[model samples]
Target: MLATYPIAATEQNWISVTLLNALRLALESLIQGNAAPDFVDAISEEYRDAFVKGPKFQTLYEKFVAKCGILTSQQCAQILDALLDQNNFPAVFIATTTCSSIKDALPEVHEAAKDLFKHAFDKLSDWKSPGSEHTIRATYHQLVDAHLSHGSCPFCGYEPIEADDPDLADPDLDHYLAVSRYPFAGVNLRNLTAMGVNCNRSYKGAQDILLNEHNQRVDCFDPYGNEQVALSLSGTTILSGAGEGPAWTLTFDPDVKSQNWRRIFRLETRLKSSVLEKHYKTWLKQCISYAQKNNIDIRNMDGALEAVGKFKTTCEFETFPTIARLKTSFFDLIEAALNDPVGGERMHNFLVKAA
Candidate 1:
C-alpha cells in the first residue's frame, strides 16, 4: 500500500527498446507466416546481438514464435500494442486464448517473455551505476524511515519491527507483480513497493497479486489513495472493553477489489498479532493517565467518554497509522463501555485500579 516511484528513465528506455525490437521481429515472422525453421532463422539474424550475447533469448524467441504461430496477425499486433502502450504484457498473455494451441504454450511463453524482460533490464549498464544504487537504496531507507516514523507497515498496517541498524540493510522491495513470474516487471518502477521484510518474503512470495480467476486485472488498494478503511476491533462487549472479543477486523467496505487485496496479503491476521495488542494496551493505559492528569471526572461518564474520544481522534492522525487505526477502533470500544451504566462503573473502576 505504499507509494512507489515511476520507472527509472534508464530502465524504461531499455524496456521500450528491447520489447519493441523483440515485438517487431515476432511481427515479421507472423506476417510471413514463417514455419519453425524460418522463424528461428529470422529471429537469430534480427536479434543477433541479443541472441549471441544472451543465449537465453534464442530459447525465449523460439517459444514466443511457437506461441505466436497460433495467433492471428491481429492478435499478435494487439498483444504488442498493449505491451507498448500499457506495459501490461501479462494481462494480454493471460487473457487472450483465442487459439486453443496457445493454451499449452502459454506457460513457456510467459517464462520466456519474463526472461527477455529481465535480460533487457540487465542490459541497461547505467541502471546499477553507483549513483543509481545509492538512490535506490536511499529510497528504500527513506520509505522505511517514513513508515517507522508514522508507526505502521504501509502494506498491512502492522507495527514494523525494525532492526537497530536499519540503514545497514534496506527493507525488502516487494515486486507487486512477482519478479519470478513477471520478469519483465522486475525493473518496472510502478511494480516495486517498499514493505516489511516479512510481508515481502514470508507472506507474498511469488504469488501473482494482479489477476483474478477469470484472468482479469484486479486493482489493489492504492497505498497512495487519498483515503482507506482503517482496521478495528469487533465483538467487544460494553461491560469489559478489552476482554473476550471476536478478534480484530477491518471496518467493512463494499469494495470487493480492496477486500481481495486484503485477503491476498492476509492483513487481518497480521495486524491482529499479540505484539499489536500489547501496543494497543499500552496506549490505552497512557490515555487513562492523561485523563487522570487533566482532572477528567470519571464519574461524569459523558464528559469522560467525550474526553477520551477527543484524545483518540486527535492521536489517530498524529501517531503512526497502525497505531492511529488501533486507537480509533479501541476508542470506539471504550466509548461503548463508558456509555453503559454498569459498564461505565466497571470501566471507571478499571481505570482507577490501573492508575
Candidate 2:
C-alpha cells in the first residue's frame, strides 16, 4: 500500500461520493418534509425530487427496512452523515464502535447495516459517465493510475500489475475496511486501495482491520501513510548437501502495526513459500549465470564476491520490479556469508569450484 496511487484532489468528490451524497439529501428531505434540492449543476431539483419519491428510492428504502426492521428518518440521516463524511474518512473507520452503530445510532441491525450501506453504494456501479465509456472502477483507475503503478504490489511483493493496458481487466481495488463488514466506506478513496488477487481475495477476505478477533481495537498500517514495517531475515545457505533443509526466520516488529500486518496479510507463511523456498535457489543460479556470461574471475574471495555484486547491479533488483527486494536481500546475505572467514571460506570455495 504505497502512496504511488494517491488520490487527486478533485477525485475527493468522485461519482461514488457524489451519488451517495445525493441519496443523503433524499434521506434528509424525507425527514424535513420536502426539503430543497441540493442538486449539482447538471441535475435539476425536479429530477432530484422525482427520484426520492420514485419506485427506485422506495426499493432501496424497503431493502434497508427489511434488514433493519425499524429504521427511522433520524437514524438514516445519522448513517448518511457517517458514510458521507468527505473531509475525514478515518473518523468513520477508526472508531471501534462505529461498526456496531448505524447513523450515529445502532439497534439490532448494526451488523446488517454493512449490507444496507453497500447496497446503496453499489448503485454507482451501473452509472455511466455522460459521453464516456468509463465504468466506475475504470474511472478510479484512470484517476489514481491503479495500485500497481509502482510496479509491485507492496502488500505481498508477489505480483507487479501493469495498469496501462486497456485490454486487460482492472486490478481489484481492495476495500481496506472490507465493504462486507463496514458501513458506507464502499467508495471512499482512503478505504479503497489495491492489492493482488491472492492478497485481496484469498487472504484478507472480509477481515476487519480495526477490530481484532475478540472485537478489540488495534493499530494498523495506513495505505498512504509514511509508516512502513521492516522485515528481518535470518537463515543459512547450505553450501553442499542433499538435505532440503535451510531454516529461515523472517521477523517483524512486535508492535501492533507489524503484528496485525503479519496477521492480516498472512505474510509469514506466504514469504516462506513464495520467497525463501521458491526464489532462494533461483537467485543463486542467476548470480552464477551472470558471472559465467560476463567471464568474471571467481578465483579469490574478493573476485567471487565482486561477481555476486556485479550480478545484482545488472539485474532489476529494485522494489518496483517483481521479486526485486527478494533478490537484493538474498545477494546481500550471500555477500555477508562470503566475507566471513568461517562460513565465507566454505561458501567461496563452493562458488570457485562451481565456476
Each candidate: what lDDT? Answer: 0.55, 0.60
lDDT per residue as tens, model 2, 1-355:
3233554512533544554555566556655545324334223443444335445544544444444334566765665555555325545444433443352246444444454446545544454445548655566666655444565666776665547457886667677876655555666666777667888888888888776667777766666655555555646454435544456666554445567667778887888887778877766777888877888777787788889888877545455543565566667777888888778887787667655
lDDT of 1: 0.55
User: How many collisions per candidate?
Assistant: 2, 2
lDDT measured at residue 153 in model 1 versus the true structure, 0 to 100: 60
- The root-mean-square deviation over C-alpha atoms between each candidate and the true structure, in angstroms, is 6.2, 4.9
Query: Residue 152 in candidate 1 has what lDDT?
Result: 48
Candidate 1 clashing pairs, residues 3+ apart or interchain: 1-223, 150-320
Q: Give per-residue CA lDDT, model 1, range 152-207, as digits (tens).
A: 46666654635325345545656676666545455554555667777788777877
